[model samples]
Target: MVRTAVVNRVQDLWVSLAGVGTGFPTGGVRVVVAPESRLCPPCWAGIVVLGDSGIATAPDAATAGFLRESLTGRPLRSAVEAERWSGERGVVDVLGPASLAYLDESEFRPATSDAGIARLPTGHPALARLVADVSEDDVGESGIDEITSAVFVVRDGAGVAAAAGYRRWPRSVAHLCVLTSARLRGRGLARAVASAAVADALRSQLLPQWRARPEPSRRLARQLGFRELGDQVSIRIAAHQVDSNGDRGQPGGRRP
Candidate 1:
C-alpha cells in the first residue's frame, strides 16, 4: 500500500497531467480525463485509491461503465492482483503489477567517473543509432522528442553500450527510461548512465520517477536510491470506440 501523502501527490500529478481544471471523479467511475484531444492510456485511467480500492476512469461513459463493471467488486490488494482480475475478464490488456519507485535529492548518488559516458541531447543521432544498434523498440523517436531533460549515453567500439534519460511528466516528475545493448548486458554501463540521468534530474529539483517492469530495472532503481513508492496496474480495453449510450457497441474482445 502507498502512503496517503504519496497517493495525494499521485492524484495531483494525474490531474496536472490531465490539464488545468481536470479533477478526480467524486465516486464510482467517470469519463477519463485527458489533455485536449490526447487520449490517456487505459491503465492511466485506472488508479489504486486508498490502498485496496481500485477506481477505473475512462474518456467516455461507456468505457467507464465497462471498467466499473470489471473492477467494482474486487479486492485488489496489489497491482498484480488487479492485473490478474483484469486479465480474467478478457476485455482489457494488463500492464504493470510493477513497482513505482522514486528518488529524492537527499537519497541520490551519482556514479563515479566513467570515460565511456557522455551527455547527449534529446533525439541526438548517436542516441538514435545506439537505440537502433540495441534493437530497442520501447523508446522511439517520439519518445526521445518527448524527453525534456538530459540524455546520458555510454559507448564502446561496437556502438552505444547503454543509454538513459527521463521524460517530463506533470508536477515536476521526471519519468526515467533506460536501455542497454545486448552485447553489454552484464556490464554496469546501464547503471552508470542511469545514475548520470538521475543526478541530472535531482540537480534540476525534479523527483525522478522509476516505473520498473524488468527485474534488472527495478534493482537498478534501488541501487540509485529510489524507494518503492507503490505498485501500479494499467488496463487497456479492446474496443476502440464507445457509443453515446454508454455501451461498447460491439462484442468486446480480450488481450493479454
Candidate 2:
C-alpha cells in the first residue's frame, strides 16, 4: 500500500523538477528548468538534468557557459563521459558527480522488529554520541535538528553501533541518512538501522530518496530495495559551498 503512494510521490517530484510547462527533452535528456531552490535545497546553482543521460551544469558562469557550449551539439551520453569531459576541461575542480536513486518501496520487505533496534525521539542524548561516531560535517545534512521526526539507533556495549533517520525534503520526500561505527563494520548494522528508518518514512507517507556517491553506498541502497533512477553532477562554487555531508556533497571533487 505504501509502495503505490511512494511511487506517485516520486512522479510528482519529477514533474515539479522538470518545470511546470515543459515535457521531457527528446533523445533521453530530461532537463530540469526550474531554479535550484525550487528543486533541492542542497543544490546551489546549476542545471541538474536527470534521465537516461544525466548531466550537472557548472555553478560558475564561465564553466557553466562552457558546459552549455559542449552540450549544444551533443547530449551527455553517460556519467563516465561527463566525468571525463569535466576532468579534461579542468572543470572537475568545479563540478562533482553524484548518483541519483529512489527506493522501490514496492520491492521493500519489512524487516522484523528487532529488540536491539530502538527508535528515539529527536534531541535524545544518545543521538549526540551517534552523530559523533560519524563524520562531524554530516551532522547538518542528517537533519537531526528540531524538525527531525524519527531517529533509530542500534547500541552495543561500547556505544552506538549504528544509526539511521530521514529529514524532510521538498515534495514530501524523506532524505535518508545512515551511519555505522567503524568497529561494527560488516555486521549488517547499517542495513538494520536503515530498514527501521525506511519503515518509518513509509508509515509517514513520505518517499525515501537515496542519493549518494556511487559505489559501496549504491550497493547498500540496492540491498535495501533502491534502484538507480539516474545520475547528476553538482556545481561547486566554493570549497565551503559544497556540502561535506556523506549523502549530500563530497568535498575535493570526490564523486558522490
Candidate 3:
C-alpha cells in the first residue's frame, strides 16, 4: 500500500511540474506544453487565475500558505510548497505521489485478444461522453493531435467494461480504465484488459502507471504488477453547469 502511494505521489509531482496536475488548464488555458509520455494536456502547477470571481480557487491549508508567501516574495521552505502555489487562481490541486513499482514479464499474463475489442480513436465522439460520464472536469483537449491518447474498449453485449490505452511522450505510460457494469463485477474482464494494456506499454518501453482513488483499487494495481510510488493529493471542486451553449454562468471565469 505504501509503495503504491509513493508511486502516485511521484506521478502527481511530475504532472504538477509538467502543468497537467488537477488544478491546471486542459484545452484552452494551456500556457506551455511539455513532454509527457501520457496524452494529458500540459497544465500549470500553481494556482489558476480567473478573470472574474466565479469559483473558489483557494489552495489547501498547506498550499495556501505557500501561495501567500510566494506572492509576498517570501522565502520558500521547500520547492514542494512553491510548486503548488502561484498567481493562477480558480484551480484546485492535489500534489504528491503514492507508490511506484516496476513491471516484470513473469508478473504479468498475456490476455487473449478478442475480435470484438476494438481500439477507440482519441478523436472518436464516443470518447467525449465517456469522459463526461466520469466527471465534467475529467476531460481535456489539446490542439496538438499527436499528444492526444486513448484506449480501446470491449462492450459486453449491452454495457461497457474494459479499456486499454497508452501515451508515449515525456515518458511512456499505460492507462487501464476499467469499470464493470452492474451485472459483470465478478468476471475477469478488467484483469484481462489491464494486463493487455501493461503488455503493450512494456513493448513500447513505457512505464505503466495506474490511478485508483480508493484503497481497493490501489491494491489491485499492485497485484497486477504496479508497485507503490507514493501518495499524492487531488483537490476537486464541484463543476458548475455550463449553459446549453457552453457559456459559463459568470462571464470568462472558467478553466479551459
Q: Which has the greatest TM-score? A: 1
Q: What is the C-alpha lDDT of each candidate?
A: 0.61, 0.58, 0.41
Order of quality (lDDT): 1, 2, 3
Q: Estimate candidate 1's RMSD in Å.
A: 5.2
Number of backbone-clashing residue pairs for each candidate, in the order shown: 3, 2, 51
- Comparing 1 and 2 by lDDT, which wins? 1
TM-score of each: 0.74, 0.71, 0.46
Minimal lDDT window, size 10, model 1: 34-43
Please give, for residues 33-104, the per-residue lDDT of candidate 3 as tens digits: 222312122232222222110011222233233234333433222222325432234334444322334455
Clash count, candidate 1: 3
Give me candidate 1's TM-score against the actual structure: 0.74
Ranking by TM-score: 1, 2, 3
Candidate 3: worst-modelled 10 consecutive residues by lDDT = 48-57
In the range 1-256, model 2's lDDT, one tens digit per residue, is 1235554565466555533344334344433334332332343333444444333323233433444544555655543244654543323343435565677568775456556898777677776666676665555444445346567889866567788888787798887887776567788887888888888888887788886774776788888888766555544333333222222222221111
RMSD in angstroms between candidate 2 and the native structure over all alpha carbons: 8.0
